[model samples]
Target chain A: MTDAPPPAPPGRHDRPLAPAGGAQAVSELPVVTTYPLAFTGQAGEYFRIWIVNTALSIVTLGLYLPWARVRQRQYFYGHTWLDGQNFEYTASPVALLRGYLIVGAFFLAYSVTANFDSTLWIAGLIAVLFFGLYPWLVMKSLRFVAASTTYRGLRFRHHGKAGGAYLAYGLANVAAGLTGGLALPWAWFMQRRYQVQNAAYGNAHATFRGDVGDFYVIGLTGLAVGIGGGVLLALPLIALFFLLGGANFPEAGGETFTPGLVAGLVGAYLALLALYAVAWQYVRAATLRSVLNRVEVGGVVRTGATFSPWRLVWIGVSNALVQALTLGLATPWAAVRRARYVVQGVQVRAIASLDDFAADAAPSESALGEAATELLDINLGF
Target chain B: MTLPAPDPLSLSGVFFDGRTSRDRAATLTVSAGEAQLRVDGGLETRWAVTQLRIDPPVPGVRRVLKFPDGSRFETADDASVTALEARTGRNRALGQVRRLETRWWTALGALALTLALAWGFVAYGIPALARGAAKATPRSVLATFDRETVQFLEDGGYLGSSRLSAARQAQLQTEFRRVTAWAGGGYPYRLLLRDGAPEDAPFQLGANAFALPNGTVVMTDQLVALARSDRELLGVLAHETGHVTHRHGLAGVYQGLGLTLLSVAVTGDLISAGTFAAAVPAALLRNGYSRAAETQADEGAGRYLMGTYGTTRPLRDILARLDREDRNADESSVRGGSRTEDLLQTHPGTAQRLRHLRDIEARGR
Candidate 1:
């Protein structure tokens, strides 16, 4: 005899609710956002945390750099607010570590194989081979991370498919290349779109860009040279030593000097330094202006612009020199500069009025201290 | 007669699920005698529409009509057709409602399978292969490739190679140990130095070096002499050792095997065992990997330099120098016999590698 059919499993069989995709916008249920449906807490707050971490990184002369990025991303996302509430961040350290290890392992193997093999053509062929699938792999990895996020009364969603901001950014990059850097501002805009597209706060989209005053009138490279050169010039003894050579030694008779060599060195150094200063000014101006461009926000769109790289580059160079001279001490200035750069760029498209809306005592106030939809989960156990 | 105004259109019918869709129009031909609808949609398709039945508001006279595009419309003028014709769509293939005929269970199962394969290779394949090479190969046959390749062989060729003598192998082991100690107290490391015939001048034609499983690194004399400078030598060695510490060699074969299989699955083109056999020897004649892999290796190499030497700039210098050599030789014909084909290799561009190393260094410790 045929066995009777088993009953549908509980909860598993219940149909998942379709996305809130009807033409008519649905009014969300009234639940004070103890957590915003976001991966970060607040726009300004995200910047602050990133800045602090980035600063520390700069002090280390890039040694602590990766960690700084990780920390900034983690903190901003972990404590994000969702619809006035905090969303849960769920990325595990282990997952990130595993990814690093596996990818690292592959990287090494390829090196050896390539080293032993003489057919150099295979290198390009293989990269081309993987190029076709890179988008798919990125999509998979991104989606996995996204699916792991949660927000106020809604799970976070990822649109890491063959569409949207990625395409725009790609086009902008091509434009930038074609325009010989003239299209940087437009490219910067595309980058803003890419960043904010993933940001969500109670279904309200948020975005950002470099501030109007943030860009450097000079190019980023130019600005770097200017600040770096100016700082170097300020230290007479240091400048003289570098101008002569990094080898600073006690002088015989209060000042031992070689006229021709010293004069020639000084002349060449000043010439190069002067050129660098001029270029730095332009680059610095351009970079700041580029970052100061506005951040745009809308439903399904949220991101920010930042001009901090020029500051970062200048800080790093100065700090690197300081380390070179002092044997790695007194690097806080560099770190601070680095931190500020990243912080300025870290935007959170949260519910625009979140902090203001959280005027009354509410659970979401706890969320203000957190980020949205990333790794940290407020009340995750529940 | 002016074609009776086409009847008002309605998207009332259920649509079919299709996989292969194209944004194009097509013609359909049907024959009653054959009782078949021939859809000339310029694409092969399969479709499905289950339980297609229509109940009319009222019974009506049936009608048949024809259109000028050489088409016909057959239906009751007063009644609607409750027909489910596998949901017709032009230039679209209806994905057969499938029970996920997937080896995704197979693909998801791949990780475990790969781990198993990796273990097998470690436990059996590597030793067997090593033994085979050592047995069939002569230790005295040091320079494996033609002498013309020496300049390009970065490091010189293998030392005398009837097969590495037990004594020489022991000595090689000692040197590897020293380099290993330099890298760190104890990291995953191995050294495989294929000592070449000293006859291969300047750059050993048989030169090559790579890290193997669990810290095994192989280097040929060709690689050593090929480095025009001491720093370049150090850079090359450090880069290889970097692979050793990272266990790149082992991971690579594992990954390559997976990718090659995937490539074959997607494109039914198969490389014969003979092709691989030929390819291996030919590939061994040069030092290169797929561009993506090379980039990864460069990064790994850079990291190793950064971590071990606490400086990575030298690597950038070395790569740039080598790339210059490669590029200049071809352009100036300074070297008579350099292979033009090698320039078109799939390995990451030399400039790109140098840039990668620089970027890595800039990323900091």
Candidate 2:
């Protein structure tokens, strides 16, 4: 309830600023203040909203999805606080409905065409068109999300060019594919750099100083650990199955499953799932730390994140188990728990006062791209 | 234009002018449906309460009021803001939504409704819809799918050239034609004999028979070898013919598509982990659908065998033999007997299926 800023941490003021790309020295700055972000959304409250939204979506046969999406976004954005002020989502539900309908129509057309023999070529054409326009759609989606988000009345912006998006997404994907996935790390680095460096708060553009080598280190290591650990963990369970005399090798294609075999298979599956969760969390945490920690906005506001990969893995794996056990009833709690951890880990350091950034003249963005990206399961959030 | 304010309700807040991130201490007073903002060491502004947009109140969060000029006021005085908002009478529906969101009983009721609705949709809605979709599908589409599936199977080495003798193939094909004719010739049926147990195939299909959507029946060479009598092979063919007649393959495709869409809609933004969790239910639902299709096909085959041979014993014998072979292949006396395992299985238990066939035969008699 207090409006006063938290006191600077001990010895933080005396610590010199590490020279970043285009960042000025600490001696030239007047003062520095660090504000940690906070998420105040409660699971209990969000559970209610989730239930209402889900029920209404079902009853309306998904017609109310736009409103549900807006409500959900508003709840999350309104509860996230930085420097005692919350973020705002200003997108209209009607705009989102237009986008949803457009995307829905496209999907229906594709599915219908795909099912018919003569019309199959139309489905192929649609796919080709979608792939060709993907970069533009991604750029528009970024701009839409940024233009809709507001903190302290100044909207965020994404000014990444369509050409740049193509280079980051289309070219990078081709390179990764050409290398048989060996260049995946480079692809991720390019995309992250594009996303981070093109982001702006009000009129202040952000910068990314992350290195590509760091991405390779994290990406390859995660893959190795995931696969190696999964095999190691599963071997014993499989061995146990054979040892227990449940080895139904299915000679001559007479397939059969015993209780022991089923148990062993399930155990092996869980082991692999756990290892995958660990690896994915590790990569996500490491990449987030690298990108966010190096981000500087307007050469005045610096951002940093500190996340433990193991903690993320625990949260993710446990959340999945809880969701599976409860048949998705505990989804709200899982989301809130993860969001709270991730959001609170972010720290914003500003050498200047937080009240100086000016707004830009932002053009209104249609939600078609946003809806398309969401349907494709693209994660644009930083 | 300033009139004397009556019954003015005042609260402390911060104001933002929208052009910049600047914030300042301010006092907001609401009276007679008009609101006034007095910024400390700044300008005074006023607006009609109806013209201002107040964000729906979240519990323990400050009320944010948006002005017509893109400026905003944030205040922690929820009570005073709620009092002011009551006069505007806007956002009444949203207010009700917020109320529903905040109450325990309403949320509980909503959860129950969601579960019940999901259950009903899965139980009855999806099957009915799939049946209708299957019926509406053009024959050309079904033929295309059937061709593509067969081509893919052959290309993938899941099916190989039959090693059976030309004489055996001819005899079986002739019998297959006769059976199709007797079954009303509803479709232009084709019988394909293939070696299904390819060494490098992902899964072994030693003795199997399946029907495509366009009445293409594939009988494996191993299945021909396993049959002790021609009547058994004919019975298996009758069962597959039933599948083609009911368009079960097309129905299955529609059902799978419907389930995927439903899961995606239900999971919404829980993309990463939620999708993985949805797979569990999806697999279970698919198994249920497959079991239903199997039962329908069994009934159809039973009727055909009884009408043609004056007994359902051929189909029943073959099915029971296949089940025993599967059980024996496990090298254990106990088969997949647990309830959970039964639920997950694509086919109904042999005992249950055999019992149904007996009941059908008795009714026919």
Give the winner by DockQ: 2
Which pairs clash (backbone N, Cα, C closer than 3 Å) in model 2? none
lDDT of 2 by residue, B10-106 (tens): 9888899999998788998887877888998969988987778888765545678889998999887877776676666666876777777778899
Model 1 regions lying over 4 Å from their true place: A1-88, A93-98, A117-119, A130-160, A163-175, A178-185, A207-293, A296-382, B1-365
Fnat for each model: 0.00, 0.60
lDDT of 1 at A311: 54
RMSD of every prediction: 24.7, 5.9
lDDT of 1 by residue, B1-365 (tens): 12343232222111111111111222222222112222334443321222122211111111222232222223322122211222222112111111111123432333344345544643455434533443343322212222223333324443444354688557656755655676662544555455554565464435455544344455665555455544554566666665544444444444444444332221212332123322343343223333444566577667667776676666666555455544223212222223444444655555556557768887875
- The C-alpha lDDT values of all candidates are 0.40, 0.82
Candidate 1, TM-score of its B chain: 0.41
Docking quality (DockQ) for each candidate: 0.01, 0.36
